[model samples]
Target: MSLAVALEVTPLPLRHPLPTPPPHHVGQPPTAFHNPWPSFHQHSWLDALLTSRRNRDFKPVPPRDQLVKIVRPEWGNGQDGLKATWIGHASFLIETPKQNNNEGGGRGVRILFDPVFSDRTSPVSWAGPKRYTPTPCTLAEVPEVDVVVISHDHYDHMDAETLQPLYERRKGKINFLVPLGNAVRLHGMGIAMEDVTQLDWWEGVQVTVPTAGSVKLTCTPSQHFSGRALWDRMSTLWSSWVLECVNTSTTATAPGPASPLRLFFSGDTGYRYVPSEATEDTVPVCPAFGEIGEEYRPFDLSLLPIGLYSPRHFMSPVHCTPEDAVCLHRDLRSKRSIGMHYGTVRGGISQYFEDVTEPPRRFREACETAGMVWGKELALLNVAETVVVRLDLPRLADLDLEHVRSSKHTKYFGIILDLFDASLKKTLERLRLNTNSFSATLCPSLSLLAQMRKSSAK
Candidate 1:
């Protein structure tokens, strides 16, 4: 089927019960959105500004080398694994695994999320929060993007400077997925309305890519408000997103099991509200995340915000502290998550209180506290650094030992055996499984198994 035709016909099956709708202001535009629960406390912006000048010992902007590690993103034709490249705050280039096409080789569908490549994340170039960290690579260096997924209309998350050039460079071939009431902004950029897909909370759309098959994009709830300027507060909607790769290919050409790859983008969200001097333990937190975890448990990868949160009373309603992020990671039931939205641009008054480098440290400490291994269950990637996850492997428990012993698909057993430790080898020995019976070329190296076991023990 043609890509457009497939998109129109293939609606993703609702896998779980639909979530409750977000509260909206009555008599306002239907797009005027609010969080599911009350998010803010009594703290005001004036209080944040008044306290912004407090002396902080840590540098807001770290040395460039230590802050961003530049590397050319290696996006191998997405035939095997899922890949994500961190392009600084709240921006990522994600490629879903691709199935083989009529052509012998092909690339995966590339989705760029909230790409802000400008020197400053402001409505006006002369002012607002300027980026202290440079982009790992220039926009020109970014590879071909198939779809652009925007989380909101915030200047930091959405930039006209980046989108306009990106539209022209790609010659309007890209599809844009945005929250409600935000399409007008893309329309203003001269993009055809047909190319933009605007979704409200709990809405989903399937996009078909010639190389990647079908991918489902869902507009999920986030506890955040949105506006670009003073008067437009709550005028538009804000959202998080869920992307899942749907297997539509009749031919099983991909390397991994047929299990779909799912990802979550926590655009910009807060877990709960914390009043000044009050502990977060008893406060009413946003319940959307737990609902999200219920609907989409075990996300293969999740990109969550972990910075720009300070003066917990004010920022916690919109931004996530590292500790809050850890809770969010657990709430979403993410298998692996990477932290973003810090170490890029230092925002205005509210952002001054937190050290730029503090987020990652706190994130690491929080992960450790949660018993989640850093770089395995959760991670903080360097700007421009690319992380790849092997989506083909099934969980260790999913493999049947009898099948491994009797079936011709011993190649999968070899790969699975390489992922565990001595215990797994001992299990194989107890079963009287002979290594000589398996294909030597198909088995992964023993070093990987040892490394995995070592990492697991920690």
Candidate 2:
């Protein structure tokens, strides 16, 4: 389908369950979109420092052989394949599906997320949290990175040292997508402004490749604070990312039918925090994941944060525990989930109940609690190990198309109602504020979608 037709049929202003804040707040910093959760409490640093000092028995780092390995060629074999390699910390090299030889030998896109190759995750090299495990692959060893996504401005997530060498190697072809208010830092790092795309929560952009298809990058909201220095808290936005690759190929020789594969990357994030009286012992969790799943559920795969949630008192508001990560997996309706953000370095103020290496163990327990098999549906990968996800697009084609479309429309209508927090549907009974208004435009686009669906179904 042509871009024009897709635009005509596409739902206007994509509906979101969580409230979205504007990219910029004129005089002051922007607030967390929907929840009134404070990004960071002012007096928690002392508690965090004291907590860190109390943890005298740090776990020994994993063996070097177990932590990192040389990159094999098959990891880059992207045609009609999905693969992911965790390089340590929060960095990952993701290879998205590509069209087969029938589609002119299309190659899948390579996406790098929160790549930190430096020895330490701090403003200066000599101080801060150093990597307990070695990186899986060096910058020189990584396959050509088509896109790099920075979740926030934190040192571990956005490393200038890594970016410098990567830029020199890619020779300016790499595209960096960062959160809002981070362009300046990237610019200071010597990357061109045109090469960087900064986004706010809910904003998105589409990149089309001639041989393959189009990948939609959406900056979704996350419950996290950002600041490299003390004074700049919450000045820049932080986010989780959702990537939707819409395959456009059609032919007998293609790997599969043209179906869209959706993936979600939970950047450094905390579980939802519901506001309550200070006297309350526990912070209530929010329904943010439910809202995310409502729109982008049944993801082909998801990378969820499963570490750094020790000492619940200080970390609960800003980080997700293993159980919380499992819940997030359900909320996103992910087909497969791999736990990340642990086993590389320490995070947050208090020593967790479990050892640093205990995230996977806790994750397994949580999976059982959630009634999912550990290796089958959910996974906790070893550093440098690769996981391949094979998608059956043809099966998607056989689904009821119109029914799916109507469900989407209905979802948006419900979102509109939720936004108002009132029984406006009855009051504005005659208003064209529901799905009926867009029926004409939406129906035609499904015809094109049907063709893609049919191919995948084959």
Candidate 3:
């Protein structure tokens, strides 16, 4: 059998495993789940370096001996609510809600998102971007997880070392959901494929929790390409995950559904389709802008990329600019967003710019210019910080929306046709959505994203 099919076919043991009640949701994990497949194909390290333009200046700072005493997770506060702890980058340990202590579970559910516990994000453990911060939650301190979700196969997004240890520690107690092609990588890494669940984009996996209800984790689309090496760029898929919790009965139409708690984990993207930029003329399939095939609504909370986009010439297509991040925050319709992938790791050599430093300051100015509102006071996080999302809280809409760039022409109108064509034709496509829609003379040069951010971080 081909790798995709073999990897996708879960063994009967996993196809229908013991239905233990997941601890957190609004009520499910938060588990020792691991992706068990690995790819045997060898990626060329030489090509990987040449194509990558990562910043290598920032090195890993030694961990704080802050004395973390390992202990079992403590069930917190209450249900009809939620909490998420950002462990840096797209990594977050979400606190799942438990109906009550009556269930035979522990301190709620602690689910880790994109937990890359590896020292570096490269094929080799030592060669990639050195982390700026030590992982905040240690393996011992981490709460028992019930489900693990792998959005894609990119190194920074998915790591072997980390998941391996997790699988060994948790065993059958954990389960995993990964993208279609990622199982190959997990299998090569020696992880058993039986317990792994692979889903295509827009597909979902239902976790049946007893009192806590169920959460249908949906894998959604993000505007980014995927590949760990040149030969396989876009070979596998990249996506953002939408984790929604349902408190109502599994069959109930409307069980007074509390705000469906959701968190969007943006794998890696360059903010392409903003409802604001999409127009009838530009979008082929659904020319009427906001009506794109499936215009996914804004997530309740979001973790967005805000860095690695200096020297616009090359980075524009792959990484998002600070301003673009602002625009994405708007496009995704997220209530509160935490900036990530900026300060966590910086190992790409192309990242060497004369003026910029780590934690690129331009994003702050961009948010300010866009009048972005986040956190308790509604301000962008200057560094690694945490914020709680409240559906019924006061927001910072005090920006001069009239003067924001969205109020002006961003030149995205030009690509509406191309994006539409790609969507309509249903053939696979890749386009670098730069600020400049591309002049007829320069359209050929468009694919050479080496010319991305020469101008600004903002």
Best by TM-score: 1
Model 2 Cα lDDT, one tens digit per residue, 69-153: 3343335342245667777768888877775532334456678899999998888889887877767666787877767889998
On lDDT, the leading prediction is: 1
Q: Which 10 consecutive positions of candidate 2 have the poorest summed lDDT?
A: 408-417
lDDT tens digits by residue: candidate 3, 1-458: 11111112222212212233321111123112211111011224663465454543433333434211122222222322344555556666665444342144433344567878766888886566666555655665665565677777778778888788877766655667776667777777666787677765456776653323345566655555556775776566556676665434222342344445566666676543222232211321111111111244435556677777644434444566555555455444444556666556654543454223333466566555443332311233322233333332122111111111112322101001121222312211112134123311121111132223222222
Per-residue lDDT over 1-458 for candidate 1, one digit per residue giving the tens place of the 0 to 100 score = 11322123244555544434435432334746666476544345677656675654335566776665555555433225566778899999987766554232355667899999999988888988888888877788888777899999998988999988887766546788998889998998787788888877777888776545557888888888788887887777889999887654443454443667678999998877777544565566677776776677657778999988876666788888877776676566566688999888888555557777778888888777654556666787666766665543334232211111114321111111133445533533322232222211112123332343445444
Rank the candidate models, highest lDDT first: 1, 2, 3
Clashes of 1: 0
Better of 1 and 2 by lDDT: 1
lDDT of 3: 0.47
**Ranked candidates, highest TM-score first:** 1, 2, 3
Score residue 364 of candidate 2 by CA lDDT: 85
User: Which residue segments of model 1 deviate by more than 4 Å?
Assistant: 1-22, 25-31, 39-60, 76-79, 101-104, 249-257, 393-458
Q: List the residue pairs that clash in candidate 2.
A: 257-455, 257-456, 310-352, 393-456, 394-456, 394-457
